[model samples]
Target: MEHPLGVQPQMGLFEGGADVAAAMRTRGLGALACLPDEALLNIMHELAPADLARLACSSRALWAFANHDELWKGFCLDQLEGRWDFQGCWQDTYLLGKQAKGFQPGSRKMRRAAGLQSDLLYTPWLCATCAIDPSWLEVENVDRRSGLSVAEFREQYEIPNKPVILTDVVTKWPAMKKWSRPYLKKAFKGGMTPACLPNCVVRRFDKTFCETAPQLAKDYTVPEVFSDDLFKLLCEARPDWRWLIAGPYKSGSGWHKDPNSTSAWNGVVSGRKKWILYPPHITPPGVRPSCDGADVASPVSIMEWFMSFYEHKASTRCESVGYTPAECILKEGEIMFVPRNWWHIVLNLDECVAVTQNFVSEVTLPHVLSHLRSRSPALVSGCAKEARSGLYDRFVKALKEHRPELLERVAAEEAAKKKRAQEQHKLAGLFKGPEDACPGVNLANGSSAANGSSANGASKPEASGSAAAAQNGTSAGGGFSFGFKL
Candidate 1:
């Protein structure tokens, strides 16, 4: 259909050059003017920063399109490489980074749109406000266990590689009562260091937030089930482990595994969080993680993943089969155990505050060791500088000196595994039976000895092909078969 504003839907808005753009301007964007911000942003996405900035100068509509933070953010990143020195939105980063060295930013004023709902601007708000259908919560399931002893946990879920929500684990944490957003905002009075800012370094933002205010660290303690963190052997030199995560609705992590092949526990302080977890073997729908675990190719936004793939996953996911993922709402004061390297994504259903820690455990030590040794140092993370440089060797050395029992147990386990393998090799082709059957064995002609058969006497003819198989109990190819007539 022709656009009411006379735009040919087939033609791009700016395809024919400045004259064409001027004509479109005089003619107005027509249907393009009426397009949803997202679709219009898609058109604007094709433009270069200079062209986009020029377009912003042309008119209010184009200015709105051109000034989007996302557009500038993409430009900010594509324009530079390595650690970002600037902090703020991509537009601010671009302006900040583009300034001459030692540039001192001045007091700047931000232009306020009078309730303009640009898809470039307001769609994120819409995604945040979109009501989560109740049925969305009921599609999949994971077991919920509480009051499990360490042995019970290891024997049942940890060893079996399953995800579970532990209800009573974090119930007594002081953070559960004290760590509201308002309290946190007050507790977090100081500004974050340059390294803690988003797009900076490898540490979690939550840890950075807590590091800025050391008092916040006292609000929670490690649960008994996870108190066996092997990283503690490295003490102050261990990699950053715990974090204080807080976010508004519709904000949370994308698909990822925890760092350094460590299992994790996320204990919610307040509000609701929806968790969707798949085992180590199953990658969540629409996620493509590189094999070495460095880069992820998937929708960076939680809303994008939900809007694009969640329903399809829910509909096709089967609880009794491979596609089903463990799904749950982790409410206030609850702790969730995410096994090592299991793929998971967490979405906040409300304003939320939580603490999460990734730690190496006895169950995951070997896996972490293999990951540390096999991956390049650049890809390895979640540790101090000295540990990061030679994590596998350092960890093994620490294990031998301080935690020799762990190594001894693992060595014994390895020896047992090798013994099982040897036993399997010895019995490769044998099965239980009362006696052996021999083919082409005859007591009168010593056919049994000639055919390497030890069995009751039997006579065999020189039948060939199918005839041999039928009369002499021989293979169709004329090879002797083992048989015995009891």
Candidate 2:
């Protein structure tokens, strides 16, 4: 059946085998019940499998809430690694698997959900199926172009830090003709790489993996406009930048900026993608970044945001802010350039296949460096142990050794920024009522925004191993951990 968004969800196993969304309306668990699915997931995320199983036995209603397959998928990913071959669903698969910790697979009897049909239960099922409202798309489109040279692209979009849809670019990619579900499945049939299904793995599209999966990597090349990624100076130490993305209609991330203050290019190889983007300055409705910016809170699913906030709330925000979002329905073989720190969400119009790569270039080199230097190691994505701590130093050292010219430019830019900040501070001080405190650092001057931007603006990307990995937080705009959706 068609959903309000005009697409039907491909039927699959265990789609509505949860009571989470129904609880959103009924307060089935009293104060703890009927919250948004993300709130429920957050609470469940802290519970162990044993605890969840215990909750299942509390009552028939909580049984439905606790037995969610998505929860178990997360538990499986957290406790184990590699392929998940489900024996009915993730819960049955993990508990029955040898790696199961506290419970045997299928050890506990699940209460049969018999008379639980309602619009409320359908709420969870609709989240399982299709639910996006077509009316959510009341916004303007980004700029579009064809046959633009690299210099023109930089002048019009990159340097100005604006998003644009490259109308004709992806038509040249071999992926537009070659990639699809059966073909991708067959390409990795030899299993040189463990093919991922439900819980996807972030394939590092580096040299070795490219040589092994030449068929996949050779399908597309980075468009020249964004090929100047200065992060290449860090060599292999660079974060996870490219991803192989696929999902059903409505399966995508919450609103977020790219991590490490990098810009991006996303090209669809198959199916259409719907995109809504807010500029670096405009945070989308229902999205909140923590004070430290180490965490970003957003609606649990793409559909929820569009349904709950896209109309009046978004319009009111836009009217108050005097700006609107840049939006589009990206068709097959069409690519998008997402500028640095732009808040964006990509929803699939159907089963879609795509590749997105994050990058840093002259336009954003200074901002990227500042972020790496200031943020806590825990908030950074795609580094391990010592590499994480020394990332900023390593990038700088590499830039100084090789791209000395770029480093010099970055230094000049930083100096100019400080000068601007100091001027703004001095101007503000003219209006200052004598509280006799104007330090050289300008901390007491109260107009520090002129001097420089902070790294706290970037979203903390949840890397591999959680079921909700891709739910709200994003890294490079897509990725997840142990059954977590990235």
Candidate 3:
């Protein structure tokens, strides 16, 4: 006898599984059931998630095959619509989705320390750029008298990187007034001590600490702490804002550029914050001055130096070591926009309560997309493997067509800077001495020479003496003087 698909039949009744095969054949599923598991899986792979899901419901074997994680992973990649990677799509569906439970925030320390060697399973969060876009933030100068509406705000300051202070947005929320230092202390009890503060262990203010701390994570569960009406208003008004609350330390945030793909708005509800911004091309002045000697003499590189200083024992004392940051006291009902890729560090002035969001709007999309195209070609090109395929070819094409000059200029400047640094190091080795040993100090002092005055300009000689004493804790020579302001 012949099988339904016209192949010769096997001799035994149970060869094709009598009961199972007969039932499957009657239901027009004989071919699928008789096929090897691998062959069946290959056929199913061509189906979409929805179609595959429906097929899985047909039988227990089909269910098992469709439920295989490899299939799900492939399904996710296909569903990503070419905009995100498989891992990103999985994260969006399984981690960030509203239905997902016990979602954990990522740790910066684990990320930096592990680098690229970390297992993807252990570190599943998407990169900051993937998580949010800065261009969607809409800012409007809310008239203190006339009420601010969401539409008006979106229309005015929809550009990337410009954050506006919304005067009345959260004024009615009780948490706006209730969340404070005392409240945090009460909420966490003894756990609110300096030892438990965010980035307190490293003595740096890092968001990762807050995300990972057991106590803070538990405290974050306080349901309905924020008013439903307010939450709803924000959700309706700015559907794109990803609310973030950071707290309870004076640790300085790391200096980093906001991913150009996203814009952020931060509001400090209970305390003050100091923001230090450095232009994209320039390192923070303090960092620039200390780079070479600090990089050469210490095992820790210059990058690590700044990281360590900011991460150092969180004390108010070191606050005076550098330029005072621009101060802003964000109280209840105030908002501040942080534009894209602006390098900034934030100091939590008190037990701070704040909310922040990254957004994308129509006006900023062009700029944001352009930035993403330029900065993260690999991300757009899929991953390492696919990047070498058609993705890389597309990237090269785009570079040649749209940005050849810009790319060339960037390469040239990098080469020029490298050459200058090499020359400086050679010169330093030849003239190694106290005054000339560090060109940075000499340059700083020389600029201060014209003033011939103290930092406060109260008294030139006394100020000079104080500075000299502070430098090496000695005024050994009567002629010794320090000219620069602290």
Best by lDDT: 2
Steric clash pairs (candidate 3): 133-262, 134-262, 134-263, 136-359, 136-360, 136-361, 161-339, 161-340, 163-337, 203-311
- Model 1 residue 368 CA deviation in Å: 1.5
Quality of model 3 by C-alpha lDDT = 0.40
Work out the TM-score per prediction.
0.65, 0.69, 0.32
List model 1 lDDT by residue over 306-325, tens digit each: 87788766332112133556
> Which has the greatest TM-score?
2
Query: Whole-model lDDT for model 2 versus the true structure?
Result: 0.64
* Candidates 1 and 2 compared by lDDT, better number: 2
Q: Which ten residues in a row have the lowest lDDT in candidate 1?
A: 477-486
Question: CA RMSD for every model?
Answer: 14.7, 11.0, 23.0
Error of 1 at 350 (Å): 0.4
Candidate 1 clash pair list: 37-119, 239-383, 438-482, 438-483, 439-482, 439-483
